[model samples]
Target chain A: MSVTAAKGFTAAGVAAGIKESGGEDLALVVNNGPRRAAAGVFTANRVKAAPVLWSQQVLKGGAVSAVVLNSGGANACTGPLGFQDTHATAEQAASVLGLGAGEIAVCSTGLIGTRLPMDRLLPGVEEAAGRLSEYGGEKAALAIKTTDTVHKTAVVRGSGGWTVGGMAKGAGMLAPSLATMLVVLTTDADLDSAALDGALRDASRTTFERIDSDGCLSTNDTVLLLASGAAEVVPDGTEFTEAVRTVCDDLAQQLIRDAEGASKDIRIEVRNAASEDDAVEVGRSVARSNLLKCAVHGEDPNWGRVLSAIGTTGAVFEPDRLGVAVNGVWVCRNGSVGEDRDKVDMRYREVGITVDLAAGPESAVIWTNDLTADYVHENSAYSS
Target chain B: MSVTAAKGFTAAGVAAGIKESGGEDLALVVNNGPRRAAAGVFTANRVKAAPVLWSQQVLKGGAVSAVVLNSGGANACTGPLGFQDTHATAEQAASVLGLGAGEIAVCSTGLIGTRLPMDRLLPGVEEAAGRLSEYGGEKAALAIKTTDTVHKTAVVRGSGGWTVGGMAKGAGMLAPSLATMLVVLTTDADLDSAALDGALRDASRTTFERIDSDGCLSTNDTVLLLASGAAEVVPDGTEFTEAVRTVCDDLAQQLIRDAEGASKDIRIEVRNAASEDDAVEVGRSVARSNLLKCAVHGEDPNWGRVLSAIGTTGAVFEPDRLGVAVNGVWVCRNGSVGEDRDKVDMRYREVGITVDLAAGPESAVIWTNDLTADYVHENSAYSS
Candidate 1:
């Protein structure tokens, strides 16, 4: 269950004819709300897509009635015309749903530098609105996939029957500051925009923001949260936040598992840092090292590459005090070779690496994918 | 002609049995000098290799009689033992060349965290010294190759009958801050260590330090200059600097052209920046973009990927004021589609990308390579 798992939210997916393959490529979700509270976090990329720019302004109103998304064209680098297309799409959705255009949020995916096929997308929005239903969550999830091999959805039930659900689509161009993906969450818990913002931020910080699949940030990344207050249950802030985090974590894991052409889902945990930020900085450095990723793919447990990556970071650590473990084997200690690398088994699809800074008490974990021939094959053959 | 193309240098290469392939893996270059002034620069990586640390100390003496380098093991992360190995290699070279131990420099490449085979290496130093000749420059260049398919060398005859010649070897793990490579330059100009340092630093700023092949900086990157003053030519500082720059530019181009598994050598030129530093930053940001590199490999002029890479940089620029060109075709103008993309061609091995910031008058160029399946194949099959 995705958005429809929560009460007061209706969703639909439709074939927009924007995708040349003739599959479902448009999704619409509407909140039938008593309290229309909403919050959103968008890509930090200065070069944002058309929908991203429009949705950022719409999110400032602190209320959202619906969201329209398509997966055929990203509508980035199309200049003023792209922004106009996004505005018109939102206006079209507003007219059909009898809502204000400013209250509608829009998200887009697929190839960048191309304008959306407005002729096909506008009519498809109307078709999606006509088919909106509580059981359409799975279809909506399926419609937003570009290079994704599987659709992602997560759900959690909170106190007093309150529910949180989310759907996300991303396969590559994953980096910090949101990466290249779109996410939407719906909740039936009674909460204000302030609570939604706080919960959403907290959930994303340790989940979506910590993954680096390919170390390439996208211009269209977006995460949105909407509360309809239809469950009529005033859930505690802590419980609601945890529920949101659970869904985000699930989605993040799914993204990593399905990262394009990735043979190994690598978990990089950096511990004993001077600060939490230092831990993240060190973790991201290792996560982005192509050398380490290749070593993981080869099951070589080459911890020297890990040390080199750590050296690039501005983290507090003595060179000789650093330690590295691969697949639970401490292959390096005191920055020197320690255990036998052959003892580290990486035959599975998941690779675990832990870097000990031996400096302080802070820690962080970052998820990434290994560099494989398949990753290069998939990325090199296509433009998206 | 390589390092020995200069008037006062002799070189030799010998098989040290350090490489599993049983190829030549040890090199010796000696200066028959009237003046023995020397200058050196090493990897900026905080996790420096043992040879780098030792050579840094040796260069501080402003004199060098010879250099010993091995190509099968990078003496990094081996702790004190690695440092001892480097020191021993230098001492062995000094003994063979009849020079003081403190007057020798050392360098090493290949896999990290492994101690050199001192038993084989120390003996090989004497063997190489016995075979040293003015025509052994190419042999020394060949001995330094790791995964490189070629041996790089460049020579420039300068004003007043002086000459500058060099050799470099790097195929992978290449990035800014020197890359995973070893370079040696020799000159017969009558110059002090201070003059050589000034010219070497100025030449490298726009050459070796501006390339980003895979964005993995190695701990063993080094560039050293030895001035023997045997030509009896007191070359002008400006002329000497120009000759050094010529050699550096030639070697840098060779490195990019021969970058491991790369099908496209990409030149990223960032122009119209507020400052030279900003231009370099922006150029490097685009050069390191895997997405854009993959696009270039696909022969797709996807300027949107270029804009996305630029957005990640802190260089001064407005999104609406940016323009991008691929292969001299202006596909994007003022942050929007400018010309028909179908008009562009990308069938060549060399790809050129120019990003116009429209901010000011400064510019910089960074050389890089496209990501390919062959690259992944080479990097993932074994640890290097």
Candidate 2:
């Protein structure tokens, strides 16, 4: 139970011919109750998908009765006709659910620059609406996968009998600003749209925006949070926010673990920077270094590449004052060789890199994967 | 004849036993000049190698008598002792050549975080000095190879008896702010240090700074232009500058062609931008996308990846007004499907990508290489 883990939510997943492999490519989640408060975040990329543009407008009204998502085509870079198709999709969903089109949000994922198979998609929406069930959350999670090896879901319960649950799908192209992925979260708490918006932004700012797998930003990334108020418990704002953050953090970790062609999950922790922004900038710079990533893949404990990466950023740090550690061994101290690199064991799948800027008290964590030949193979033949 | 192609330059390459493979690892180029006027550029990376820091200070005086380069060890991140080693190398060369230590520049490239073998390196410097010959440029070029498949050299003759020639060595970590390479250009034209400085800056700004092989900036990149004034000809300033530019451009192209594990040489041209800066920003963004590079390697006309990259920049462009052409075929027009993608042919080693922002009249071109599985293999085990 993903979205349906909370009360007042029903979901369904249906097979549509949109996917050439005939996989389940359509999903629907409905909020059936006393409140329809909602909030959303979209890809920061200027060239957004048609559904992203449509859903952004729908979310502006601070309410969403239903969300319709599909895989197999991103509906991005399809121009005016694509926007019209998205509108038609929302209209079809609204007609079946007896709700206004403005209350329906739409999402899409898959190959970019292709038109969706509306012929199958529109009818599949009706089928999905007919099959809506409170226990259909698992199916809904399974329907929105493109290259993900497994679907991701997380749940957190509040002390006051409220809960937050979410599902996310992403395998690659995960970078900052926001990971290139789709996420939907549901909560059965008595909260207004503003409260949901604040909680979602705060949670996503630190969770979805920290994992950078390949540094490629996508055109169809979206995250939405819908509240139904079925539990009728007005929990403390701080507690609600913490619950939402916990769920988002769990989903983010799951996405990183399932990243495309990744063999080792690397955690880059930047500490002792002058500010949080500096820490983040340094962490991201280190995370994006293909050379450093490859070194991590080989488990060479190459700290020089880390220093080289850190030097490229404008973050506040002194070259001579910097320190680096691989795993638990301090391989570099005061910008020079420190402990024995051979002492660091990298035989495990999880690799930790700690960078000490030695500037101040701020820190940031960034998750990434090592570069491998499998990654090159996966991306090279993806479109073919 | 590379550096020796110009007058009044003697060079030699010697195997210093510093390399485990017993390859030639030391090179020396001396300017036997009536004028020792010179100009140099170093990597912008703040965490610079010891040799880069020493050479930077030497070039500040606008005069250089000789340049000593080593390929077995970068001597980076080795703390205070690394700087002392570089100073010692320069001092040994100066003692042999009977010049001030301040006039001897040093450059080193190889595994980072390692110290040079001063015992062998000091002896090799005297040997290189003794063997310096007018025909030693080719040997000097061959000595600077770390992972380069082939040595690179270029020459351009001015109209009035002046000549410009150079040698460059780099195969990876090539990115802007300057490609991660070491270049030494020799000119026999009668020009002052200020003239050589202006010409070298103008030439490298357009040539070496525009080729981004793998988007990794190294800590030990350096480019130097030395004027000997042996031709006794005050060639036309414009002609001399053009000659220098031509040689630098040729070397830059060779670096891209020999990029590590690259299969296709991609030329990305961003046109009709709001400014030249915007064009460069867009071109670099697209050139650095591993997804697009992999697509190019697979010979897939994935214009959508190009557009997605452009959207991530802050450049001025309307989403629908964008256009992309792969291999002279306009596969995406007005940000949507245009002519048939099947019309595009990409069976050769050269791939061309033209992105029309359609926002203004400015344009810029960037050269890069396609990503391949071999790249991952080479970098993963580079140090080990």
Candidate 3:
């Protein structure tokens, strides 16, 4: 169960002929709600896609009835025509659902700088709307995939009589500020737009915002949440927030595991930083180093690359006070060789690297993938 | 005629059995000058190698009698022992050259966190010193290779009967803050320490400082310039600076062309930026984008990735005012599609990408390499 796992939600997936591969490329999610509260978080990238621009305007009033996502054309850098195309998609969906266009949200992902196939997309929306079902969450999740090899969905059951579920689509261009990714979350709990917004922002800060797969941001990144209140149970803010965080965390890990061409998943934990920001900065610096990533892929246990990456950052730390560990072996201590590097085993799909700054107590964990030949081959094999 | 093209400079290359491959891995260059003025630039990375630390201390007096470089191991993160190894190497060179240890500099490159074999290294230093000759520049350049396929050298002639020559060694870990590189430049012009420092810094700012090969800064990067007044030519500062820049530019281009496993060399020029710094920032951002680099390698005119990279930077530019051109074809104009992407050609080793922010007249260019499968294979094939 994905978005439709929660009560008061209906979803559908349709083959829109948008993807040249003849796969399902259009998804529709609707909230049959007693309360139509909504929240959204978009990419911070200035060069945003048309759907993101339209959704931002639709979310201004914090009320949403439906969401439409397409996976074949991003409708980005297409000038005014792209914006008009997004408007038309929302209008067509709204007309089919007998609702206002302003209450519908839109998201698009695929190759940028292209106009969507409007003729096929508009009719596909009506077909999807007619076929919408409460058990169509898996289809909806599969339809919004570009380069993803598998569909990703997460669900969390609350202690109260409410539930939260989400579906995300991304395979490449994954980084910290988000990439060419799109996510839709649904809840059957009594909540307001402000409450959803606060919880989503807090959940996303540590979950979706800490994965750096390739250090490439995207112009079409969006996450939206809709609350229907069909369960008639108002959850405590903390309880509901924790559920949302859990789903996001699950989805984030799924993205990293399925990142394009990755051979190993690396979890970098930077502890003893002067502050949270410093910890995050240092962690990202190490996570984005191509040398370190390649070494990890080769299982070389090259901790020197880690120190070099950290040295490039502006974090407050003494050079001689730095420490590093691979797996569980402390390879470097006090910025010097500590243990035998040959003893550190790296023959696993998952690698753990810990950096100690010995400056303060703040810490951060950043997930990244190793750079490999297959990654280069897969990325260069296609333009998306 | 690398460093020895300049008068009053002698160099030698020797094998110390330091490299397991048994290649020449030790090099020495001495400036038997009427003037012992010197200036050097090192890596900005805080976690410096022991050789870098030793050289920094030696250069404070603005007089260097000789330089010793090794290619088998980088004495970095080895604690006090590493520093002592660097000192011992310098002292051995000074003894052979009949000079004070304080006047000798050291540079090391290759695998970090490894100590040099002093038993072999010290004897090799004396052998190199005994064989030092004005015609040994080529051998000296060859001896410094790590993963480099060929030796790199440049020579610039002065109108006043003086010359400048240099050698550089780097293959992988080639980033903007300098690669795991070592360079020794010698000039026969009449110049003091202050003038040499001013000229070297000015020349390097726009040349060596603008190339980002893999976005991995090194802990062992050093560039040294030694001046000898044996030619008796008091050339103008601008002339000397221009000559130094030409040699640096030549060497920098060679480094990019011979970078490890690279298939395409990309030159990103950001134009119409709000400021020169803004232009540089945007250019570097585009250069460092792995997705864009991969797209270029695949010969795809993916300007959307270009805009995404620019969006991640803090450069001041309106979304609609951005423009992008590849190989002189304006593929993206006014933040939308302009020319047919099919018209853009990428069947060449050198690719030119120009990003126009339309914010101001300032512009900057950053040289980079395309991400390729060969790069991953070459980098992961060896630990260093």
Best by DockQ: 2
Residue A55, model 1: Cα distance from true site in angstroms: 0.5
Candidate 3, B264-304: lDDT as tens digits: 98999989998999998998889888888889888998999
- Poorest lDDT segment (10 consecutive residues) of candidate 3 chain B: B171-180
Model 2, span A1-384: residue lDDT tens? 799999999999999788998989899999997899999988888888899999999999999999999999999999999999899999999999999999999999988888998999999999999999999899999999888889889999999899999888885423432225989999999899999999999988888888888888889888999999999999899999999999988998988898878889999999999999999899989888888888898988999999999999999988988999999899999999999999999999999999999999999998989988888888888888
Looking at the true structure's interface, with contacts defined as alpha carbon pairs within 8 Å between chains A and B, what fraction does model 2 recover?
0.77
Can you tell me which runs of candidate 1 are displaced by over 4 Å? A172-179, B172-179
TM-scores for every candidate against the unseen true structure: 0.98, 0.99, 0.98
The two-chain DockQ for each candidate, comma-separated, is 0.71, 0.85, 0.74
**Can you write out model 1's per-residue Cα lDDT over A1-384, one digit (the tens) per residue?**
999999999999999998999999999999999988999988778888889999999989999999999998898888999999999999999999999999999999988788888999999999999999999999999999988889999999997999999999995422442236889999999999999999999998899889988788899999999999999999999999999999989999999999888889999999999999999999998988887888788777889899999988889999988999998999999989889888988999999999999999999999999887777667666663
Query: lDDT at A63 for candidate 2?
Result: 95
Cα deviation of A19, candidate 3, in Å: 0.3
| lDDT minimum window of 10 residues, candidate 2 chain B | B171-180
Docking class of 3: medium
Alpha-carbon runs more than 4 Å astray in model 3:
A172-179, B172-179
